[model samples]
Target: MSVVVLDGSTVRSFVADEAAFSRSVDARFAALDTNGDGVLSRAELRRALESFRLLDGGGFGSTEPPPVPSEVAALYDSVFEQFDADHSGAVDHAEFRDEMRRIMLAVADGLGSQPLQVAVDDQGGSFLLEAAEHEEAMIAARVRKESKKEADGK
Candidate 1:
């Protein structure tokens, strides 16, 4: 038998890779972007969070969703605050993408070369890896922009 283990840095690098992160983000956004609008309204966000609460307790496939838990209800506010980086009360794809990038990169930074192997079971679902070129550029630019903002704010 052969075994291979990836360190935390390796896993972090995999997530930091712009293309890979964005694909995961994209799929998540697609599911959450109800009504086919490019932007996520506050209502859409609240509803999504409500759905998450139900799913968290094995409520999936149920005709009626369970009530939101108190913790998730509180988390809903913080999550929106984080996701809407500009706090404009709405999250467009760019803001959402940039915010996600910033978060993933920050986590990678905090991992700081620690060792942590990764394993995956696809379970037949697919993850799109080849993002549009402009998407890559957008992430890079947003990262730079947020970095500058952080620096300037500090």
Candidate 2:
């Protein structure tokens, strides 16, 4: 695991092993595949959204909620399409792993300047080290300012 610290209080960890990352992706996909139909349909995606909302301390009943935002729906569809490369309308384990690897590589490339390092402790916790580059630091500052402005408006 590698840790990225945004500030004194905000830190996040990322698994270093590609296999571990793939496993995590597989687990999430399995949890969201409500119908066990191999492919994730719109209904399954809705179920995933509702589940995530509940996990984030929101409320959702067994019945599906009203229509989701068009942008959100389109994003979901696009992700599924990308993973289901053969147009099989379903993503097998291998396909899922491959797509996950590609996504991870892209993310790693984006953060190339802030390279990640993994350290294992005695308690078996993986520690992630993330050192922000000049550009990343600037971006973070801008984001913080924008967030503060939004909060003040509220």
Candidate 3:
């Protein structure tokens, strides 16, 4: 895990970079499509969500026991419904991308402009990680530009 300082603008900036955003999202989608079918079945998505422990509110870093099985099932269904845009049984790449974009934007809106120090899994290809990496790259570029300017002046 790594701690990164980020604000809404940082996430928004990452999302605004279409190429980077699409690549990150696509990579995640591909990973979730475990069957190599070019889409995610309900089972595939459910398994991924369950493995991440994202199906229950209490599952995330909480010492509380998991929610009832039915409750978790319903929550999983709701999330799947959000991703399955056309009432289809599966989530195609476009649907997955659109839903992910919406979710990330919602997170950014909730975060607003307040910078927060968040602990994120360094190995995960999560949106927060992408945003943090983006911010770091921008900072590095600025530093390199400044150094070049100073050297040229000398």
Candidate 4:
């Protein structure tokens, strides 16, 4: 399902309170780290995305089901590249926390007074995936509609 995530107040609050934000980020990192490994790999990130049910949805019709696992992995790759700071191929809790703080701060600061709400809700950074999915759906639907008309000799 598509969801709306408002980043202004929530992010601003997190930015304003470093301790609380750290705790919150730590809790999230621990969850995503899984296996108590203290680091998040591509596999871990994929698992986390699946667990959050963030890897799929947005009216994907029967002809075109939600993204396959590889597509999700590709998304994770881009996310990891951006978040992995140290080139360790894995993201530690500290790195995760710092990155989140940076992203939240950017949103809060860059957008100014207006609340920034991204429908993609990918947890961090761009909503490119979400926007692309919606756009593709619209295009697919239009194609299907036109095809049906042609088949009916319209």
Best by TM-score: 3
Tell me the spans in candidate 1 whose CA falls farther than 4 Å from its real position.
1-5, 46-71, 118-154
* Candidate 2 Cα lDDT to native: 0.54
Worst-scoring 10-residue span by lDDT in model 4? 125-134
Q: What are the per-residue Cα lDDT tens digits for candidate 2 across 1-154?
A: 3334333211222334444455566676776676787766656755654544433322455455544577666766786788777877667767766775676556555545454433423232221222122225557889999999999999
Which sequence of candidate numbers ranks them by lDDT, best first? 3, 4, 1, 2
Question: By the lDDT metric, which is better: model 1 or model 4?
Answer: 4
How do the residues 1-154 of candidate 3 rate in per-residue lDDT, one tens digit apiece? 8888999999988988899999999999988988899999999999888878664556558888767898888988999999999998999999998998898889899989999999888886668988989988988999999999999999
Q: Write the per-residue lDDT of candidate 1 for residues 87-147, one digit (tens) a residue.
A: 8888999888887666655654655565443333233222212222233455699999999
- Badly placed stretches (over 4 Å) of model 4 are 1-10, 60-65, 106-154
The lDDT of each candidate is: 0.62, 0.54, 0.89, 0.66
Model 1 alpha-carbon miss at residue 55, Å: 10
lDDT (0-100) at residue 144 of candidate 3?
100
Evaluated at residue 1, the lDDT of candidate 2 is: 37
Q: Record all residue pairs in model 2 with backbone atoms less than 3 Å apart, i.e. clashing.
A: 2-128, 3-128, 3-129
Tens-place lDDT digits, model 4, residues 1-154: 3454443444565455566556667767877777888899878876765666765655546455677878777887888887889989888877887787787678666656564445554554232333334445556989999999999995
How many clashing residue pairs appear in each of the predictions shown?
2, 3, 0, 0
